[model samples]
Target chain A: MRKPPYPTVLKPYGQALLDLAKEREEIVCLSGDLTRQCEIDLFRDALPERFINVGMAEANMMGIAGAMARQGLIPFVHTFGVFATRRPFDQIVNAIAYPSLPVRIVGFMPGVSSPGGPSHQAIEDVAIMRALPNMTVIDVADAVEIRKVVPQIVDLPGPVYLRLKRGEIPVIFDDDHEFFLDRAQVLESGEDVAVIANGMMLSSALLAAEALRGAGISVAVVNAPVVKPFDTRTVEAVARGVRAVVTAENHTIVGGLGTAVAETLAEAGLGRPLRRVGLKDTFAEGAKTAPHLFKKYGLSTQDIIDAAWNALGRTDSAPTAAPTPAETGEYAPV
Target chain B: MPSSTTTSEVSISRFADTIRLRAVMMVAPQGFGYLGQALSSAEIFAGLYTHAYRPGHDRLVCSPGHYIIGAYAAGVEIGLLPEEALLTYGQDDSDLEAIGTETSPAVDLTCGSLSQGLSGGVGLSLADRIKGEAGRRVFVLASDGELEEGQTWEAAMFAAHQGLGALTVLLDANDSQVDGPVSEITTVEPIAGKWEAFGWHAVDVDGHDPEQLVRALDETGSDPRPSIIIARTSTRQGLACLPEDADGHFIKLPPDLAEAAVQELESRLA
Candidate 1:
């Protein structure tokens, strides 16, 4: 695979967290045996007094984080996204989110970040967290943004669910870029079409934009890292000017960025031709390679390009026909 | 003995009675609650708040959150909450939420899922230890039914291995659960022995006796290991109007029997 236009930057979000732990004594970290994968080893080493390993118990880790928060300690509970979401969603909802505690939930190995196959991929985490009340859902696009956003989330006085990628993710944002918790950032501006993306899909969206640019279709890329409390204003404004809107996410199409953008547009009465490029309604089979899995789930760069073209009502073939409700089902309403 | 000491002891007993009365009032609104558990556990709750527990400092998590009436009663007795809050028990727009305890200044954790409280309690104890606040204790109240949860065992192992001596678990071995008797569902017989095997300093005692409960709590300090007090209690100790076999898990007193049960409790108190 060819590298994108951005330089390969080794941005360490977890190391920055370790540095923050030096001054903030109230910051306690908990891991469920994912220390190496989560890159929180430095924090564990530096602050042995505050770091706790709850074995392989994710549910207990959540409960521990909640109780620690109650005692005026800020706990960052780290684990894989699947374990954090499916294994302990009830604890997250009742113990952490319901009480609005200052517990930072770091869901590592999000969206194919783990090569250990389907069981490790966290494609549905956003859907689970966004449905709950008082939960701030965030998907960091790259390491630079993750480091910038981590400290800000600690300061915010509520439960924060931060999705982090494992290992060295290519840096998409510049160091000088000012990132906010709830605000959307427009990386590139154009009037032809708007491409909304988050997480690893942000890089794909940017790549798809370049591919579209070569083919005479101007596209704008907006990085919406925060899904819950989404930037509806930005979505509405951009949707009005663009010919069609395409949403890209490394999550399932059901309740991730695609659903969030569609909901916003529908609510604002600006519904238009929109295409969502994400995982289909299915679990990862755990047999295929990561690249094959991405291709099969329609999360590749080419998939976004095809989706953008489809949204613009463009057909490469000779046959042109009217869309039918019977054929399209729910897509007809959109 | 000095007269002042005698007066203080009487006041403490009165405080325990106030907790029982507040719990009884809260249950009256719903027509019923875990009244047996509340009544049996009132004295222990009173002692914790009045003597053992340092309010606004230490942490206490109720594992079997269904026994919210007892916790509310303890809060009311200690003036942490008002007695009028009991009027909203099981009512709409009431802070007294059914099943799950609502988040309030008086409540430490919103515990409804069984076995979560012990894990949460371990977290608090670890936090206190990290802060070097060794005097602060983390108390968790677990019901007999809660032992069925695997997470409780995980927390038990965790607390014991960490040597969290400041963490204390009080088990209300009422021998009752939702389906039927705890033994029928899953026998937790020899609970004290099981806890001892798990590396805790286990103490089995009559849950209803306030003096025994206090003594057991005092002994916990002497042991370096985390403590578990297996409180032997009855499912329906105070309200004898109901049949002994009547399941106290979710008591549904008919309208006609409600007045009789209340009258019986009043006569017992008198």
Candidate 2:
């Protein structure tokens, strides 16, 4: 309800990248004419010689990154999520991921974060990049996590597709929060229900968990940042003990965090009743703000709360939180 | 015809002829390969390996993936690959597959996907420039069909924009694609002009002439801008001695016709 304290989450990412570049000369920054949008201008400004602006050509940027990686320089490429993943999928898969090159493809405006709508949203990046043999996929929850995760992947080998939130994001984690690659962060622990979320969706999940706790529901929130190597061990342990499960994300429910959790639980034979909250097999139309789009697509904290209650078999019977906008009928169903 | 051919030029021409013959012979057993494309690109490879590309120092990238036979034959000539391994091409458990990738023993980078090698070459050249490996040039052997890909133009733009003088692209303008002639499928004509417009020092040469190709490739590097040698060639340049059926873009070389083609190349080399 209040204004987010952070003006832009991507500044930390840009600062982190610049810091990394300062630490290692092998670190080179590249952009697809999104230096300002992706907040890579800081890196560009600091290390002008190492920064390469490849213009609007995503595929060429990827190919050049692959070539740069081959030359033993670590190239961190930034673009719109869709352009970074879908437009240049072949170049990433063949030239980068297939060869296990260490080209970090940082995709901003992931999922429904892009107000530019379907063309710009990278809803399927996680699914596609997850399918790659040697790709490491990570969706950071907040700016604090971004500052920690961005620098860690520099030393790691092989290709990495990092989904990021760009401008004016809510701050979640504290300053001392540390990040580990391929590890899940358990934000809150409870016995009755487990809510697994990633990227900006974790903020909503935290809010939903707070409201659920006020209702004496005792909900657990797992920040599943490393989406690809899905942290099956942690997810399995959480799903095994929890009474019910709810997975939320800003991406399609088909292959994002929801699917990752569902697959992990199903493979582990946990048989816990699960609810997936995300874009249901469709595209997000252009909207004025991300929060309105979230409320429209049933991704707001209220949606997560409702899904949690439904997963617990309570339905709409017992609810103490404020009313959701989905009940208001202002956002017509697509 | 341009100048008096030296003994080394004659030897490099023989190497190219052997590459063409080996490509024909290797594809004959399988009955399927990019024989036409390989034949036209042989002299480019020979000119590069013999004149420009240093075995351990410089890097050569094959962007036209199906030209694996030419790469393997040239690899044999340069002692990077064994001649016995040529027989195992397109066969099971062989390092030399029908398409060349960075995984292939002799290949420095992968290229099954088109329009990627020039960018890769640019990366290598850029790395060379940064690492102070000044004389270590990066050579890319691209195809006419690959120019149809938008990434090729993007790479062309990037190479010139970076002023990659150590990068030289030998475009095998073999005039045909798998579908049809390159013009009919997609008009990449004004090809030299396109490269020049992209800030490359574009040079047009006869692709099949080892001497001219050697000269063109030799002269392509050391310019301030990225250089491109558009080697104008036929799709099936060397197999003209065979029946017309042997000249398709992707041909299944019948055993007897394949033999005849080899003999023609052998006699030419002799």
Candidate 3:
């Protein structure tokens, strides 16, 4: 059993941002004592004057960023995804969102990616950030998308809540692949199943599609990185002729990719059999590795394959033996 | 627009009295507004706008946004806002809200929530330092009750750590809050000592006295830390005619009593 290549996206993100900071003095960095953990140390080391370590106070970091924005300086804040969305929600709404400041809040360890358990996992970040009026919610699918999106986010006018992949992550997209805001990337197209996914789950979706092809079940993998201001147009188009639909994410099914896709389909009157693969209503327990958490939370490639079969109403026998982990009584719908 | 009245202490005192009268007129008709908090803050607004601050350039953040009625009254007194706009206090499509928010250009920083404005003031002052924008100071006026919010302490520490000498804070210690006396609400006493321990240049002053407030705003020692003035005040300081039992935190002034209070303020100005 060999592991796939997992390249660190944080290093390249830091390198790309450091280059941007050299050209733009208004680009200031803020962190809540996770400078090294989130790989903002690259900006800190290269340009100490522009980097601000606001200790562990996430709310104050948001306030400081809002104030900096008020004074015509663009501030980028980094922290864990949970703290980024939950800890400073009121401040982010009042100071950042209501005023529509250009503060880039980069939240790493989105959803079940953090093995630090429920406290560190941000399964509801996308749901909460999308609820904010002026907030642009972006979930990066891979290392290549992260590199391309950083500059695009800098050019964006209002506040953004960016879901990030820290440490080593697999490269799923090509180096020259195009990136657009409020747009979903159509990775592979098929007629049998429209498999929409975002964040780290997109890679798993691609794997599941590849594996399903061998079983004569074609699955369309649509990488939906931008959750808020969701690409419903592209989603409907991709899902138009597909026999069934499935959505995948590392976040909870409540307000993540699954809900967005369901809403799009429901509104379009395209009532196809739909299945969602992600964390249930239950909190994740601490695990040693992402693969372990993925298995426990029912986000592995096998879960996606099972969901695809279930969506197609083929429950007699499947590629994998175990039932859709969602049906095993581990998680209740939220 | 420059104030038509003289900038002397006596003139500012009379102007502050007129502002208090205007605040009562704006809020009293609404049947419910922050009349007491607004009256208590009139002198502080007068002291800053007339003596300590340059409104067009220097920034003033109202952390305790209920006090905005008083700020708007002072703006009208100083000819910053048209006098006829006073009737539009809580009406729809008006700049004025029942609670001050991001609706108006009068407030440099919009904060209806407590304890958040100081952080904005810190950012504005820090920006001035980083951008080399000299002669620009940021003043934040907050309630003593807002000190209970953790973000206030965080902003306090950051201001001291960054050496934000250009930032000044007026902690309106009106003792009263919506939940009753702040002492009973959360025990935010020993407020000046806390600021001093946080490495700020702190001072205690009679909040109602314009002389003391102006002096605190103007004086800064060799210390490069920020400044906080603990202003001990009564929530209903200007309306001596009102009963002591009348709750000032948020009140609907009786029509007759509201008129009588305004008459007393008008007589003092006369």
lDDT of prediction 1: 0.78
lDDT (tens digit, per residue) of candidate 1 on A140-220: 777678778877888788888899876656665667778887689888887888999988888778777877887788888
The TM-score of candidate 3 is 0.94
DockQ of 2: 0.66
Tens digits of per-residue lDDT for model 3, B242-268? 788768798768788888887898888
**Least lDDT summed over 10 consecutive residues: which range in candidate 3 chain A?**
A325-334
List DockQ, one per candidate, in order.
Answer: 0.71, 0.66, 0.72
Q: Model 1 segments beyond 4 Å from truth?
A: A1-11, A286-288, A317-334, B1-21, B104-107, B254-256
Q: Give the per-residue lDDT digits (tens) of candidate 2, residues A1-334.
A: 1222323333778888888889899988889999988889998888888888989888888877888888889999998889999999988887898889999999998788767878988888888898899999999877788888977898888999998887754456677887878678777789999999988787677778878998989888898999877799988887777899999888988877888888898889889999999888888895987767787888777888888999999946555445433323122111
Off by more than 4 A, model 3: A1-10, A320-334, B1-7, B221-223
Docking class of 1: medium
Worst 10 residues of 2 chain B by lDDT: B239-248
What DockQ does model 3 achieve? 0.72
| Clashing pairs for predicted structure model 1, backbone only | none
Candidate 3 local lDDT, residue B175: 85
- Write model 3 residue lDDT over A15-50, tens digit each, in one string: 778888899999999889998778889999988888
Model 2 docking category: medium
Which ranges of candidate 2 are over 4 A from the true structure? A1-10, A318-334
**DockQ ranking from best to worst?**
3, 1, 2
For model 3, state the Cα shift of residue A193 in Å: 0.9
